[model samples]
Target: IQAFATLFQYGTFDRFPNLKFVVLESQAGWLGYLLDRMDAVFKGPMGATTDMKELPSTYFRRQCWISADPDERALANIIDYVGADRFFWASDYPHPDHTGDYIEALAELVAPLPSDTRHKILCGNVAGVYGLG
Candidate 1:
């Protein structure tokens, strides 16, 4: 959260517009709260914090991606809060903690989302972010 706040406070994204950031292992459920608070602060007393061309949420949506554990119950909700195109599934495989089939869990979690959203979360988002074709 601090890293994202600092980057936004310093206009990092505005300076290096094409730089992409992928946040790994950070369960994506809290982004909505963080962004909401950040925006409130940005619009309040500390509005002069930076010469940011846009709000923190705007930069995040444009230049960042976050990975969600396949078994996260809030995944679909998180994907909705933070654009579906900004998320991808992650499995803490071989980590001695995760269990079961990651693919199966992911498939089930994304079943109710639209096809395009599911596709992006499954693969398209990551590929596009990294120029992976």
Candidate 2:
């Protein structure tokens, strides 16, 4: 994740505002803390080392996406923190840890979310990430 921080701090998002950075296989529970930490570090004394046009977290909000596995029950809180638009539901299929029935897993994870947020995480977000939007 430091690589992501380095890229954001170094102005990669600023350089290509339309570029989308996706973090796959990594659940998003820690992203809130990481983004907050980046914001603080960049705004602190170390700010001089970076030439970002916006707060580090702002760049992330504008250009990053994270994939959440179906079994991660904590994603609800992450959704609240990161916004539903930033997440994509991934089955992580073919991996040993993935569920054998992806559809069932997806249904279970999405059951508690509101319709709009559920749609975003399961469909719209992935479409937009892949330029299908």
Candidate 3:
């Protein structure tokens, strides 16, 4: 969260308009609260004078993507709050704590979502972000 906060507070996004920031290995559950807090502070008295082309959350929505572990139970809520397009499903392959079978982990985590959202998280969003298509 502090990493993201620094990016916004220091005008990193403004400095590099085309850069795409990816937050990996960190779980996605904390993102919603962090974004909310940033926006709240930016709108509050101390931050009302913040000089930026857009709100902190606006910069995030435009410039950032985050990876969530395949088994993270809060993924759906994170997607709903932070926008589905911001997430990439991470298999954490080759790590000791990673799932034994990536496909099974992905299926279990994505099964409850609508088909389109499932497709985006499982394939489309990452592909689009990385230009894999």
The CA lDDT at 13 in model 1 is 92
Q: How do the residues 1-133 of candidate 2 rate in per-residue lDDT, one tens digit apiece?
A: 8887888778898888778899998787789899888889888888878978788778878899999987888888888877899999988888997759899989989999999999999889999889797
Q: Relative to the true structure, how large is the alpha-carbon lDDT of every model?
A: 0.83, 0.87, 0.84
> What lDDT is reached at residue 63 by model 2?
90
The sequence of per-residue lDDT tens digits that candidate 1 reaches over residues 10-127 is 8899999998988888778888899888888888878686878777889889998888887778877777777898897888776666776887888788888899998998889988
Q: Which lDDT value does model 2 have at 69?
A: 88
Q: Put down candidate 3 lDDT per residue, 1-133, tens digits, no spaces.
A: 6766888887789989999998998888888888888888888785756555577889988999988897798888888887888888888888888858888888889988899888888789889988999
Between prediction 2 and prediction 3, which has the larger lDDT?
A: 2
Deviating ranges (above 4 Å) for candidate 1: none
Q: lDDT of candidate 3? A: 0.84
How many clashes does the backbone of model 3 have?
Answer: 0
Q: Which 10 residues in a row give candidate 1 its minimum summed lDDT?
A: 91-100
Error of 3 at 115 (Å): 1.1
Model 2: residues >4 Å from true position, as ranges?
none
Ranking by TM-score, best first? 2, 1, 3
Score residue 41 of candidate 1 by CA lDDT. Answer: 85
Per-candidate RMSD, Å? 1.4, 1.3, 1.6
Better of 1 and 2 by lDDT: 2
